[model samples]
Target: MLVAVVLAVAATVGVVLFTRVATRPEPAARPTAPPPATAKVVRTDLVDRVEVDGTPGYGAATPLSGRKQGTLTWLPEPGKVVDRGQPLYAVDAVAVPLLIGSTPLYREIRADVPAGPDVRVLQENLVALGYAEAGPPDGKFDAGTGRALRKWQKAAGLPQSGVLAQGDALVLPAAVRVDRVTAQLGAAAEGELMEVTGTERLVTAELEKSRRDYAPAGAAVEVRLPDRRTAAGTVRSVATASAEEGETKLVVTVAFADPAAAPESGQVVVVLTGARRDQVLAVPVRALVALAEGGYAVEVLRDGGRSLVPVEPGMFASGLVEVTGPGLVEGAEVVVAS
Candidate 1:
């Protein structure tokens, strides 16, 4: 009877153990930890730059017109570099030299001509040509001026008339590169004989009204040439007039510091740096997260734990964004989406 009791008790114990095993819940599924990807906040220079397509060529071409009308006997070849006292073209089989001056020749300059700015221009050119020995560049036509004119005429193989008529010479702001000869060889030397540009090469870019601030006068820029070479350039001028287009556009002219290093004419890339900051806290743009509330935030990682910290984003450049905020410092690790 005791043995029977023992067997029954053992069976009861086994049933209780099975029931406990069935009722006990499986260990809670282990919580998963997200995969880690991070980047370090850095302090470096950040620049806000705009890259635009540019045309590398001699800047705007100015039309060249002659005051005298005659057969265009000879013309300078395209791409010719003409300087002061050099022949721009031949009119009536006589070379019409280019003189450095801003005043156009309007009337005849003779021994008894009235004092004016045009007289001053002629006197300056004569002095530059080694004819005037003593005297300031006065705007007066006197005996001394007549002597200089006679000498110039003699040297140029023209009659020693001691007089300069309109169209006797071409006046230009400076030396130029012949861009094109518009008139035929035998065409009349009247209007728009040719077009010329400054001797130095330049790049022209059209900036939309929104980007006008990107290229300010005197701002330095980088130009990438067609041959894959780079050159340093300066913003020469910003046009006040807007180009006619669907959008308002401003013309920006850039001149190379070393024009000889620039390509003659081709497509180029112009990079204008608007603003820059140095030694600023920055992080990869991917590290920034748009906060649900407002503004931006970066995940600050510390001791294997990440906490979103609000930040003020400044210039965004080169896949990096300038960041500033409380608890954000250089060398701090930040979480970035992989």
Candidate 2:
């Protein structure tokens, strides 16, 4: 009877333990997130580019020379930064004879009576020619210099105003733009010449033939000057035919957009020939999954859950494709990996 009671109690205890163990709850599985999107591509219809090289050149050049056969009275070529409308060349071709003290430009500086043999000859010749009879054969300009001005004006068909006029710019044989003048009031000479450069112009560049096709019509360009400053320009002209220097061919001449910054002759520069776009979106090639519906799909992370985002793939590529899809903006976080 005692053995039976022990066996029954042991059985009841085992049942209670087994029932408690079975009632305990199990741990839940953690959820995984969706992947991100990354691709890169450029729209073919948008911007195009071309590259080239060139040297700066002036748009126009005017040459200046003496109008009369008088001596080259002034030597002012080497160190003059002439301003527009400033005088460059001067000659003392007076006729009727000037007073001893008449040099308009050099009133401060004491001038020797005879500047040199050539000047002396010029003075004598001017007096004999009736350009000026005022100054001594001392070869200096004086008050009588106006006679030389009148004579030159008459021969060149210019106004006898004596004050140099604009049309007189053409009378110079050497060819240049006239910037300024210091005519002796009474001095006389047969004719005189002076010239100045224009305020605006362009520099040309030579490019390689291989880069020619990319050289677009109306493409934007930059002209680099000797001072390391860059001026903007356009691709003005591109040659259809090519020139060969040994085995290499060269394309010729790219005109500048801005003439204000061009360098002096023989100045070399690089031509930047393209435009840039901003705020473009890009992604890696593997990030894209082609959906069965023929559209593109990317895994998006939203509300702590991963979901399939159907995207319209327009500009796609091998490595990275340019993406434009719904709810896609800069800084919008997306899951790139599963």
Compare the candidates by lDDT and give the number of the best one: 1
lDDT of predicted model 1: 0.88
lDDT of each: 0.88, 0.48
- Residue lDDT tens for model 1, 203-320: 8888877888899899999998889888999999887555556556777899989868788677899999977888899999999999888899999988868798999999898899
In model 2, where do residues sit more than 4 Å from their true spots?
1-48, 57-219, 224-228, 241-252, 265-322, 334-338
Model 2, range 1-338, lDDT digits (tens) per residue? 99999999999999999998999787787878434453323333323344345655433334343343344344345324443223344444222211111222221111333254334443444465456553466644444544665565576444565443222222212223234443333334334333344334455555565666556666666666666777776665555444565545544445566555566665656554443434456555565677786888766656777667666654443344566777665554455543
Query: For model 2, what is the alpha-carbon lDDT of residue 38?
Result: 33
Off by over 4 Å in 1: 1-34, 225-229, 240-248, 264-267
| Location of the lowest summed lDDT over 10 successive residues in candidate 1 | 240-249
Return the TM-score for each candidate structure.
0.83, 0.32
